[model samples]
Target: MDTSFLDSLSDSDFDLDLHLIMGKKSSQKKFATMLDSDDTDSMSSSTSSMRLDNMTENGLSEVQVGKDDLLDQCLDALYEKRGSTREKALASIIESFNSSLQNEFVETKFATLLQQCLNSIKKGSAKEVALASHAIGLLAVTVGPGEKAQEILEESLSPISDALRIRPETSKILSLLQCLAVITFVGGEDPEQTEKSMHIMWQVARPKLGANVAAFKPSPAVIAMMVSSWSFLLTTVNGWALNPKSWQESILYFSTLLDKDDRALRIAAGEALALIFEIGNLDKFCGENKDSSEPTIDEGKDSRKLMYLHGLRTKILGQVRGLSAEAGGKGSAKKDLNSQRNTFRDILDFLEDGYTPETSMKIGGDPLNTSSWTQLIQLNFLKHFLGGGFVKHMQENQFLHDVFGFTPKKKLLSGTEQRMSGSEKRMYKSPNSALSKARTQLLNKQRTLAQGRNAGHFAVDE
Candidate 1:
């Protein structure tokens, strides 16, 4: 609601600053040759005139500084010992990260800023955790090519690894995982790097899948992030990643999850499986290995992959049949069963119809077989959650009792946490927040009751 910040920008050339930060050259004759020899000397002279007497390491006072000098001032303010000043600096720096060239410039002191935030998580206030988490996620998504990104990986590993092992609060853990996801896929173009990152993430996250600790249970939102990250990696890197043994482990774990009570988790896992089929080269992997030295494809590593896909395929049949059978029964049991049928219906709908790769935007470099597997996932979502026809004769031949054992149906809110969402938070400052409004309503109600009691006494006096 305050326009006071705009006053500070009155003298700031935002457009020019952006152009200079991004290193864009203007073709106009007036500034055609950006920062020419003469301009460089003029910039140096102007920068030299700016006094630092009022500037502190923790804060920056508005002053006339050359374009070159502005970057230095922003850095000083960013690293300010004062938290508020540092937050302001972080905001400025985060915005500049939009430009890759400028992002590299910010990376000049990246380690320091990252360390400051990473350290904050240990003892910082809730507000501090929120800010630091956001900042870390931003840097993770940006950063540099292999070298700079590698530096971030090395430096950030300790803090993140500790956080994961320690199993901190839900918020902290989510933030940490989010940062991991972003960093791992820094440039989705590079399959090798992407594959390595996915491996690292799986190494860290797999432990939490059925972790003995209470904090490790993947919530709906967390599962969404985890599976989606895997899906993104699969889509980005293509099916080459499927060559690893971990692929089966990942797919096997997710296939069992198809029958999970949490519709969201089931959907995430299911969609992740679909994405794997679409991008993970199921045909090459289906009951076939390139090395002929091994036995038949079914007996090899692809054996389990095939079995898992078959298990998920048959599991879908039983699930829909069970739903139909249960819904046909009488009484309250029938009603509850019908409710479940609807939930299961939603989970199966995409598999039944929604998997359409033909309609999906095509990325270059994808193999033709990728579309075949994708079509298979859509046409026979139940046939092969990932990919099938590797052993078509084995369809519904085996019981899925082991792969998808019984999980007690949880009430919709059974495992839910107690935190309110951020829906009420608005962009601009409000005269009263939701909390303030609630308090005001309570105070007014109390006042009305008191007035009623006083009015009754006056009537008695009359």
Candidate 2:
């Protein structure tokens, strides 16, 4: 397996049509191209946001370059005729931005530089475009999630709107979508900016997502991006329910995801919905839940909110029923149609049980939903995993070196198939995570073996 992610993307332009990327079949292949930008960067700053860039800095910046000189270097490298040189330059600037984000001069120069990168996205080959898209995300985070960055990002988005709206191929679309997600998150620090970015994303991304995508079949990469983007919106927005239009659209889109047979898409959609209930302050409308972490309508509920929730619930439930209709005989299609039967049922059950005392008891008896807790646990684990300690250990261990190179990153499925039907089944850990844990376990085994051998040697000497 070629671990040279950028080299692979740079090698050729993958002009993949929707048919080529229609289902899970081509999804893995297409995503292989999209795999280059995960927690990699030359330097560090916004790992809390974009979590990428960590490439070798050798010869990238031979001498210590000043902030202005660094920006000049980035632009110069980006404009280089050679793809490798250009990518190296872009990676350098991204690293600088990450480590010294608060520097005013760097922020100013980098902001302009980032816009250039966005504009350049349309100019390059598949690999070039992906790298350019990546630079926009990395540089945008460098601008920080302040009020200033928001305006700059908004300005940059307009220039790229047509590309997003017209709908490009899978590789290009993946890059653009990731750019949207990383910039919006800004390492999850600025709530206001995140909200605005979410709206901007919805505006640009809505028509191209879920029920209304490239064609009758949605792009897996695009769908997966929506799952993440939408979840962030619900989880972070202060008044998420205030935007009636977006709220309605989110429902249709999320319901569309919840209906997916792909485990990841379903979980992303489900968790987004769950977050809405938990933090959307739905209790103001529906009341409170005594048992679960989510709010309930145990007290006097607001009729308007209840009516609104009921409306959304009704729409979702209708979708589930339509799915239950099943297309005649038993086959893949039929199985896929009703695959999310239990998931949708649980969502509805959670909705009903939130307020119904008796249903609450029954729901409590059911297997605990560990889905909601995943993000928090993963966040802490990431902090620990990315900590100095973890990296040092990885550096010391030989097998761990290559193993820690990547991290497990799961996304929603593309092209419609409903295999991951349950909430528990819907989400998956990163394969990189499994590998990391395996290496650690192996290291422990080695330690035990060494200890035993030393004891035996000592016994023999005695």
In terms of lDDT, the best-performing candidate is 2
Q: Per-residue CA lDDT of candidate 1, range 436-458, in tens?
A: 23432443344233333322211
lDDT of 1 at 204: 47
Once model 2 is optimally superposed onto the true structure by TM-score, how far is the C-alpha of residue 46 displaced, in angstroms? Answer: 15
Q: Report lDDT (Cα) of residue 200, candidate 2.
A: 53
Task: Give each prediction's root-mean-square deviation over alpha carbons.
Answer: 25.6, 21.8
Root-mean-square deviation of Cα positions for candidate 1 versus the true structure, in angstroms: 25.6
Worst 10 residues of 2 by lDDT: 355-364
